[model samples]
Every structure is written in C-alpha cells, then in structure tokens.
Target: MAFINGPVPEALDREVAATPAEFERDLRKAWPQGVRSDASLSLELNDGALRLTILLEPLEPRRIGLLTLPRLCARYRFEGGDERARTALLTRLDRAMQRGGG
Candidate 1:
C-alpha cells in the first residue's frame, strides 16, 4: 500500500469501551508525543517517520440493566508507511489496548 500522500489514506475506525482519557493514556504508552485536540489525537511512530491521526467521537453510553459502559468511535489514519509496518503498528496498538475479553 502507498503511504505519504499517495492514492488514499489507510484508515481504521473502531468503537471502543472507554473514556477519552483512558484511551489516551493507553495510546501514550506507545505514542508518547501524541497531540490531543478537543476530541482527537495525532500520533507518530519511528520518531515522526510515520503518522497516525486519531479522531474520537463520543457516543451515547450503553446501559446494561443497572450498569453503564462508555463508548467512543476512534478513527485512525495511517500515513507514510508500508503495509507491513502499518499493520504491525496497528497490531501492537490493538494488543496493548484490548482487555478483559473472553
């Protein structure tokens, strides 16, 4: 896949179960210098050699009986990396963020 403003951007969007602060903290473990806006984040890898822009959209909390779960739509945009590198980056991130699943 072509990165660095070639063709189209490689993006992924997933609904996550956490607050922005929680998600950002986990992200910072990998991307320490990620920039945060009102509801978004811009991350980098390889000392800025590659970029990942994250846009967070808050969604209505899902209520389960007496309990509730936070929800957000996280959009990731990849730039300036090959498919292998990008896939590896995303895989690492996913592994880091996933928790408490059967």
Candidate 2:
C-alpha cells in the first residue's frame, strides 16, 4: 500500500458512510467501456487515513459457468496532515470522484 502524507478531513470521514453513492459513481466512471462486468468498492480507514479500492469482475465470457472474481483496478490512500493540506486533498478527491478521475 502507498501512503500519502496529509491530513484527512473530518467531513470526509463522515461522508464515507453517509455517501456511498459518491464512491460507487466514481468507480463506474473509472470503469472501462465495452466491458461487461460488475464492480465493488471497498473503503478502509486507519490511523487517520482513508483507503479506497475499486474491484471489477467480468460478467461475460463465463468460464465453467462461474463469474470471474473481481480484480483491483484502482487504490487510493489519503493521509491526515495539516488542516490546510487536508482540505486541499479532500477537495481534489471530491472532484476526482465527480469527474470520474479522468
């Protein structure tokens, strides 16, 4: 896992559970087109840091009549640092989620 040295905003921690759609939307935006698959998002908080992971599993071209397991496509970690830095990082993360990180 990679560590980003910065402060994690309290608001983000609160939103983690309150706004799950935000995370799902971001994952869908990051998902590749023309790929028949399903995705899952995982969030973890530890020691004032947040980790977001996107896992994708193909749905088509089934083998042995079983869907393939999801694979990690993206993993992001935000750490808590100074208030100013934390705010900046949180803003970036919010925008990235809205824009699908493209």
How does model 1 score by TM-score?
A: 0.74
lDDT of 2 by residue, 1-102 (tens): 122356544432221321334445553454322112233545432323433333322223323556442223243444555566555544555554453223
TM-score of 2: 0.29
Q: Clash number for model 1? A: 0
Alpha carbon deviation, residue 88, candidate 2 (Å): 1.4
C-alpha-based local distance difference test score of model 1: 0.67
Give the distance in Å from residue 64's predicted Cα in candidate 2 to where it truly belongs.
40
Per-residue lDDT tens digits of candidate 1, residues 1-102?
Answer: 112232333886778888878777777775555545453344344524567777777799999999999998888788787776676667667666667665
